[model samples]
Target: MKTLIVIPTYNEGSTIERVLNTTLEAIEGDILVVDDNSSDATKELVRNFFDTGRVFMLERPSKLGLGTAYIYGFRWGLSRGYDLFFEMDADNSHNPAALPWFLKELRGGYDVVVGSRYLHHTISVVGWDFKRLLLSKFGNWYAATLLGLKQFTDLTSGYRCYTSKALKAIGLEKIKSNGYAFQIEMVYRSHRKGLKVAEMPIIFYERGGGGSKMSRKIVREAMALPFKLRLEAIRHIFKDNI
Candidate 1:
């Protein structure tokens, strides 16, 4: 199947080349970097790889949200008739070596395969502080419980693979959230639509360079999106029953 890895970047110049090269070595597919007008020469660095024909980029005017970046990449892949799509980090936190495992699951008919850090009762995350870890664990629990997605261990995991059909069914253009909430919403929608979702354990490391994009606004959005999704589900049920 034709695969496309979509990496959303902002000031990721320090790590983009390594990530791109490693990803290319691991998988035989195209890569699309949706850059948000990075000031750190990220675009120029990526352009060097464009001559290889396996790498492509989309430069946004400003720092758009992560959700929009992925959405843009998704649409681009869809237009080109890609069979599989990946959401990977450009900062190398998510290992490129895991690409084969994800593709294996995809070939096995899983609609969505997520690289989970909390799967198998083990905390596979490295380089996270206790406070951040606690918040992450609690946040996943809260969102999963409220959204009725008990089967998934990592609702907010960005390292994931989606089949083309699954992406189409999820309605990419309709996605609203931009922060971590975007990840949760995609999984929830896939589960709601009865797509086959699978999780594989992966070690998530802290970025080696560039600052984290996490902020108070992102946290707030993540906290509220579950409630919003749950209410929407309820409304849909009520309307259908009526």
Candidate 2:
């Protein structure tokens, strides 16, 4: 199957080149880097590989949210007739070595496959402090419980893959949330559509370069998203009944 790995980057020049090179070695598919007008020469680094035909870059005017980047990438991949799409981080946090496993599951008939850091009994995350770990765990738990996605152990995981059919079913253009909430919203939409979703264990490492994009605004959006989604669902049900 033709696969496309969509990586969104902003000021990730320090690690983007290495990440792309490693991904190329691990997987036999094209890659698209959606750069949000990075000032740190990230676009130039990716352009070096464009002549190879296997790599491509989409330059945005300024800093856009993570959700929009993936949405843009998804649309681009869909237009090119890519069968499978992978959402990966530009930083080395998500291992490219795990791509084969995800693809295997995708081929095995799963509509969506998530690389979970907390699927196993022992924590699979590295370099996270206790406070950050707690926040992550709690966030996942809260989202799953509130959104009725108990089957997912990592609703906020960024490492994931989706088939074109599933993305189409979820209505890509309608996705509004960005940041961590974007991940949750995708999973929730898939579940609502009754698509098959599976999770695989993966070791998540902290970024070796570039600072984190997490901020108070992002956190606030994430915290409010689940409730907003739930309310929307309730409104839909009520309208249908009426």
Candidate 3:
């Protein structure tokens, strides 16, 4: 199976090289770095990997939303006839070692596999303070509860793999969120569309460098998106009955 790992990066020069090397070592796949215009040496660092031939980079004009970057990468992979696509972080928060496990699950006929830090009532995160941890837990609980997606333990986890069939089935054009909420929305849409979704436990390490992209705007968007999604589903049901 031809797999493409799509990493969205912004000012992550401090860790991009190591992330690329480790990811390439872990899986038999090509890597695509979707870099938002960064002031740092992130782009320069990514270019250094191009000699490997399996690494490619796409430069955007500016810092686009994370969801849009993945969507861009997904489309790029799809056009190139890739079978599977992955969402990974460039800051090394996501372990590349778990990639083989995700691919195994996909080969076993699952459409989407989420690498979750909280699978089966267990918290498997490190390097986070209590307040941060509480926010993450509460956010997951809030989204899952409101969207009737309690079956998933980490709806907002960005570490995930999806088959090309699953991506097309979920209707990429129909996805609405463009921030962190995008993760929650994708899983919800996949489940609603009858795709098989599985979660595997993973240890999430906090970023070793650079600041978080999380802003008040992103948080607010995440907070309100579930209600919007729920309302949309209800409206769809009502329309069908009419």
Where does candidate 3 have its weakest 10-residue lDDT segment? 101-110
lDDT tens string, model 3, 105-154? 77777999999999878899999999999999999999989888888899
| Candidate 1 Cα outliers beyond 4 Å, as residue runs | none
- Estimate, for each residue in 6-64, the C-alpha lDDT of model 2 and write its tens digit: 99999999999899999999999999999999999899999999887899999899999
lDDT computed for candidate 3: 0.93
Q: What overall lDDT goes with each candidate model? A: 0.93, 0.93, 0.93
TM-score of each: 0.98, 0.98, 0.97
Displacement of the residue 44 alpha carbon in candidate 2, Å: 0.8
lDDT, model 1: 0.93
In model 1, the Cα lDDT at residue 15 comes to: 94
Candidate 3: misplaced stretches above 4 Å? Answer: none
lDDT of 1 by residue, 1-242 (tens): 89999999999989999999999999999999999999998999999999999999999999989999999999999999999999999998999999999988777789999999999789998899999999899999999998888888998899999999999999887689999999999999998888999999989998979999999999999999988988888899999999
Task: Let me know the TM-score candidate 1 reaches against the reference structure.
Answer: 0.98
**What local lDDT does model 1 show for residue 62?**
98
